[model samples]
Target: MENNMTNKLPKISEAELEIMKVLWSNSPQTANEIIEELEDTMDWKPKTIRTLINRLVQKEAVSYHQDKGRMYAYFPLVSQENYLQVETKSLLQRFCGAAFKPLLVNFLKEEKLSSEDINELKRILDEKTEENKRKDR
Candidate 1:
């Protein structure tokens, strides 16, 4: 929810994000295995994938382990939900700023949400309102 998260986050670059996508989809893979498998989908060579893997490791986003002289695998340190929240909050803060009411008003005015979806949103909003009120004290 703060700029520090965006600015100092251990995030991978665009190229490395591809490897992360694979890691996120199927976690805990070795460098060689990821490189070999990624060739079918990505234009990058094995070395390229390896470089990305190294970069991801350095970023602390992905963790690795070794066994019997073989690097076993890696996994994402940050959950998808957390990552999504960070990105979405950044966008909202940048575009909507402190004018969330108007932002919501515009979205509600333009988008035709289903009744069920609206009800679900209302429920979520109620929970958030309760949380805000509790924090206000």
Candidate 2:
């Protein structure tokens, strides 16, 4: 599933995002390492993951180096937060009218988060709210 990679920021596919999730959690991985992680959660073959890697490289989202005997190791060029922000903004613009409240409300209604998670989100919101107030002042 190859396509153009000329977006203002490159777009990562869901499959590639899965690989990135692994990379973000523990990056600078080998292809085999990524395959092993996927094996635990997905019914995917090595080639499929390899294809995802190639796509990521083409999108400039991943960088690789050949080691002893041409073994390839990969690293994420873009950060998880950057990717998520781009995707979230795109989603908001396209479907949510660039508003996050509706999305947040939907997520809050649908998902069960831990108290710690709730508190952390609240802290983040409060921090942003405070920053915005300062800007207005």
Candidate 3:
């Protein structure tokens, strides 16, 4: 793990994650803009969306800048990759006993992976194996 990712991170709920997704796609947007983007998918009311945004802001996951006419444009402070890493680690610890092979095998058995997917996994494994061999020297 990188040093930047080693520090403690704020926990985001499912609702807050929805808001973060909106910001992540197109950042520095107003609350109304965010609501508009999610209108087709989410049935959440404007107030509910605002509440989620506020929660994220309080958590320091999202920040806002002053836009035109007193409006604030919000953006994410944490990258999606960083959050995924934390989530993956937590999941591994809780469900997979901090081991990756079991989780990966479970996924492989559950999902119908295509040939491309299998090949990609093979490529990644090869790269990892090479790196480990280098370290063993």
Clash number for every model?
Answer: 0, 0, 0
Where does candidate 3 have its weakest 10-residue lDDT segment? 1-10
TM-score of decoy 1: 0.68
CA lDDT, candidate 1, residue 61: 79
Give the better candidate number (1 or 3) by TM-score.
3
Model 2 accuracy (lDDT, Cα): 0.85
- Which of 1 and 3 is ahead in lDDT? 3
Give lDDT tens digits, candidate 3, residues 44-128: 8888899889989898999999966899889999888888888888888888785789778888999998999999999999999
**How would you encode candidate 2's per-residue C-alpha lDDT over 2-121 as one tens digit per residue?**
112223567778889898888889878899999999987988989999999999999888999988868788999887777776777678888878677978899999999999999999
The lDDT of model 3 is: 0.87
Best by TM-score: 3
Clashes of 2: 0
Cα RMSD for candidates in order? 4.2, 4.9, 2.3
- lDDT of each model, Cα atoms only? 0.78, 0.85, 0.87
Residue 77 lDDT in model 3?
92
Model 2: weakest 10-residue lDDT segment is: 1-10
Candidate 2 vs 3: which has more lDDT? 3
Model 1's alpha-carbon lDDT is 0.78
CA shift of 99, model 2, Å: 4.4
Order by TM-score, highest first: 3, 2, 1
